[model samples]
Target: MTSVSQRPAPTPRQLTRTSDRLSFIYLERCTVHREANAITAQDAEGTTHIPSATIGTLLLGPGTRVTHQAMSVLGETGAAVCWVGEHGVRYYASGRALSRSSALMEAQARQWANPRQRLAVARDMYRMRFPDEDPTSLTRQELLGREGRRVKDCYRAQAARTGVPWRGRRYSPGDFTAGDTVNQSITAAAQCMYGIAHAVVTSLACSPALGFVHSGHELSFVLDIADLYKTEIGIPLAFDIAAESDEDPGPRTRRALRDRINEISLLNRCVDDIKRLLIPEATARAAAETDRDVVTLQTDGGHHIASGINYDDHENATW
Candidate 1:
């Protein structure tokens, strides 16, 4: 019997999340209907066509009814669907992210499986939140305490800056009218942050349930990633909008968040941060690959192949 040569594995498709297609649209009280290759929102104001190809995330807040066809189109275009409550209090569910790559997911699991390695990853995330504080020697509880103090300080600082009366963070899930203006604004901005964070996390092919700091919940990882930006993006915007005393803070906060995100290039930053925070081994592995000596083959136009596999560039096979 003749021996069989192994067939090469087919290249995995790329679900590229573009930097240009980064608008995290927030919609409420509208009907999302699929209109032939496009998505549109039908409400009292009339039909407004949405550019689905470039939409990163669509926050379907209260009263937003999305048709099955619209969801199918969104899934096809790789746009994340986030179902949130009014003022973003209830993060009920989210649709799938577009990435088909499993490399990052495997790396994240391997790291978390080991006790020492898991702690190291946690410290790395903590460092991102507190660059000044050395997380190298801190335990998990210590990190939690520090983060708690930091969040309190952020609320106080923002309240002082905006001159908004702050009683504290008090809210019942799905009860948007229960909280004061400041609380409502904070909740609104935070929902936007969570929605954007989910898009970035899913784009990287990371697990939302596997988180370093926040754990044991569906949105554990989403919350962990979102917290990294509370001081910089979330709290500041809430304070600014509340300070303005806008007659309608909910819509205004959402608009301001979208603008602020674009202005600061927050989507790109979120994507980069997720990779750096979760799969740092990728950097080291890349360095190791570059350090190895490449072997040249006379066939295939004198192909010079590296020594290891690169999931990011599967077509340029190495291993």
Candidate 2:
């Protein structure tokens, strides 16, 4: 008999056989159709039709709409659907197919329970996109440390530039007391971080519910990662944006803010580095696990799999 450890690792076929299933559909001003047993999509007023054989998840923006035929096709495909509302809120549809549900759930659970594993997976993902960075020496703790310092410094600089009082108080890992001006800054900073984290989670094809370091609650693990960036990135950016313009931020200000974020060299570099370090670690952790239980499969199959994996509803913190 083959020893469990000596057995050939699960091939894609085996992984899929035991995997929870899911797919995503992103609708950013695009229309979808089913033709010749394939899904075809086109942008509004655009001629190019993108075709997909299977869809595990569906993502939509506020203005996105689905025709009856499109819904029928998706249901037939047995894909889970996720959408972002006009307010940037997120929602998900239950998967109709067992295969899709198993795959998605497994991926999501792994995402939530282990930050190190998540970071490892993120690292691999970034490496695939940017091969120049060496991943062996990089770690999540290092990234978080660098980011934490940057956030503090950025906040201070922005406060000075904007003439906003920098409260001497250092923010701890908890909710801010009400009626404090410093609290306002903290809240703004947190919100910006949350947005970025949400973007990262969405891009990574992982469910935000499955978090690593953070306790599972209303705020996502992605949100927690985003929170980590608030002081370093969000606070300073918010201050700079508020200082540069005399008028309240409208559409133009929002666009400027986004552009500013994109142009941030240090922040972008850190994010890329962190992704490189995290993705592979997470993937490896998932690969090492032997458990086949769906719940364990979800929780134990990613990097940082051994620690900080709890789902407590009371862990919610407001900033």
Task: Give the lowest summed-lDDT range of ten residues in model 1.
Answer: 3-12
User: How well is each residue in 201-267 modelled by candidate 1, as lDDT tens digits?
Assistant: 7865688888877878877888988988898788889889999994777778889989988998888
Name the best candidate (by lDDT): 1
Show pairs that collide, candidate 1: none
Reference-based TM-score, model 2: 0.40
Against the true structure, whose TM-score is highest?
1
Candidate 1 structure, TM-score to reference: 0.81
For model 1, the stretches where C-alpha displacement exceeds 4 angstroms are 1-18, 284-319
Q: Which ranges of candidate 2 are over 4 A from the true structure?
A: 1-157, 165-196, 250-253, 264-319
